[model samples]
Target: MVGYALALALPNGKFDIAHAARTPGDPVRRRPRGNALRKPAGILVVREADMDELGWYPNVETPEAR
Candidate 1:
């Protein structure tokens, strides 16, 4: 989900997944613009197969993994 958003946000569509994962932005609130909240709009469609190329690892083990 985040990868897709980053892909759209980046002009070249090249971003560091590790950096994004480590220093993530606020998920609940949108970015602020002056005194107004930035409009939350944009649609990105990512195919399941393309996720691997985007560095998405569904099976990667984490501390919470059991």
Candidate 2:
């Protein structure tokens, strides 16, 4: 199974998940509809194991040092 994270950027300079799935293939089933903040500003795909190290916040922007 693969892990996926879908983040949408908010007008307030923050990010939120539009949808998430761990299915064997195609994590996202349907395209998200656009909203006032605009839909699907960012999409991130991460291995299940790496999620612990990478963290969940897509807007955080982790440093290379880690």
Candidate 3:
């Protein structure tokens, strides 16, 4: 394999969750914080299709957290 992986980071932290992957967070983990992963506490549903549009790609640096 080419050793490609989906990199990601915490919503607010100075840690890199993965390598080769570029994103502040993964679209797959766009669920509510309360439910963690078992449930979605909010109505906001982020699909994998929107990953690129939201800056979840390599070469694209993530903006500083506000």
Per-candidate total of colliding backbone pairs: 0, 0, 1
Q: List candidate 2 segments past 4 Å from native.
A: 1-15, 33-66
For each candidate in the order shown, give its overall lDDT on alpha carbons: 0.31, 0.36, 0.33
Q: 1-66 in candidate 2: lDDT tens per residue?
A: 122223433352233433333333444343332122233465433222334454555656458635
Instruction: Give the residue spans of candidate 1 off by over 4 A.
Output: 1-35, 38-58
Q: Which number leads on lDDT?
A: 2
Score candidate 1 by TM-score against the native. Answer: 0.16
Q: Write candidate 1's Cα lDDT for 1-66 as tens digits.
A: 344333334333232221222223442222221112122343222222333355435767668656
Ranking by lDDT: 2, 3, 1
**lDDT (Cα, tens digit) per residue for candidate 3, span 1-66:** 122222222343222222222323664443333123222232333434445565544655547642
Runs with alpha carbons beyond 4 Å of true place in candidate 3: 1-25, 34-42, 50-66
